[model samples]
Target: MQLLLLVDNNDRAFLSDINLYKNEQGKFIPRNQCIKLKDTQGREISLLSHIDNSDLYGAIFTKFTVVSSSRFINETVILRGTNKHGQDVFLGLLLDKYEFRSFLDKEDELCLFISDLDEICIFLNNNNYLGSGLINERSDKQLFIDLKNNMVKLKPKMNHKEKFCTSFRFFNKDNIMVNSIIIPVELSNIGATNTTTVTLK
Candidate 1:
């Protein structure tokens, strides 16, 4: 698998060599991987020298395990992963939906296009999936994707203390059903604080 990390609107870094191993559940997951930055001339470049105290850099380099992923019809994907520090980091990837499906045909050759790293972290941290960064803030609803079933669902902006429940079906690429997962989301807004809680049912 390939991981393309975009440094900015203009600069990018590519990690072409990645190792993936299946977990106990038989799902393929990326191993601990590091990125090597290079210029157009194939010369090594220092990523740290380009930016200081970058949350995007730390999130990408830190050891993390992907927990959940959601994709939109507009070819955008939101990934949630938990780092070694027990912090949930969010990443936004931009790629054609059809291209992503093609990647599913060849799981080992999947290429991930990650962009707007910093903004994704900030927006998702605040429980705002539809934010002004990589994800379209103009969107009226939040998106949820079932990768196994190739399905997508949307939820309207919730009022304070609103509760919502949804069922997600999981399947493998071969169209074999694995399991069904039910998620209950609660949105609580009190005094100046907004909190979103997700629980499995």
Candidate 2:
């Protein structure tokens, strides 16, 4: 496995100058790999790492040594790691709304979701980009995948106020009932935290 430190906005050069090693706290320590001390026989020895789940391919970036910035809060850093198959994956550690998980249907596919939508549209052109959904129930995972398929067509529902709020789903080709995400605009009064619990049927 190999690790790379990216410049966040765009893919940039690899940082190979900083020295790093595992510490007792499980975080990588820069410029300090080992410590010298006396062993049982009074002979000088090194006290090395004893932390579990230490990543060998991970790195430590000291502010003055790695970057000139005093803090990393404003900086966007992406850590890219490659597996044995030579496929690379990147993570924006400090970026908001950035998450990647294995696909619910296929192992080869990765599911990436960005979940911030105001209201459901009246009529969405088929194959258009739909917002993200968070499956609340355990059994809803497969239901979500089957409903959110590309072959399905979903339309909004007209509520008591004569407003199109909720969405009902149907198949595009076959009459088979395929599942999809539905949002009720009435109950969608989300708080300032910007969190919504989605239900899948």
Candidate 3:
């Protein structure tokens, strides 16, 4: 997992080969796990994390303290930020809605922009992703994904299957299911089309 940081000064920072530890008998234990990350500048802050790697959207991590340390406590590949949702650690990942998408690419981007079909354009909205540079602005958040377009940003990687399951169950842990939507975008010879419909009840 990679570690990404966002600074108050609008600088992005990153740390590869991120390590996590729990003070077991005054010894920091390293647990092998995978997560996503990026970086920014400001005072470096740290959190103790236990990343649960059982889903595709990303890991579910919780914070703990094993020692009385400064801001730097333990290291993990966790994405931290703030918005209307408040400060939280996000195991950031997009839903797998694109059939022609490769998981390897854009794995570094952790910012998520969830919308229904009403909006034809999805902007990266950097103001929303405070303190993190790992996730840059995206231009394509529309229902129609240009399959022939070589640029991956024009297409979305949102996973529709996880909408009711992983998304509802996981994000609800923090009561953060506010602005997120999980719709499936399927590609056809005619172009891109949404196979699922979302209705607010």
lDDT of each: 0.32, 0.24, 0.23
Error of 2 at 169 (Å): 34
For candidate 2, write residues 82-126 as lDDT tens digits.
Answer: 322333323222111111111111221111121111110011122
Best by TM-score: 1
In model 3, the runs with Cα more than 4 Å from the true position are: 1-17, 20-88, 95-201
After the best TM-score superposition of candidate 3, give how far the Cα of residue 74 lies from its true spot, in angstroms. 30
How many backbone clashes does every candidate have?
Answer: 0, 3, 15
**Which should have the higher lDDT, number 1 or number 3?**
1
lDDT of 1 by residue, 105-167 (tens): 443423233332231212122222221112223111132332212222222233423565654
In lDDT terms, how accurate is model 3? Answer: 0.23
Candidate 1: misplaced stretches above 4 Å?
1-10, 13-17, 20-53, 58-73, 83-86, 104-201
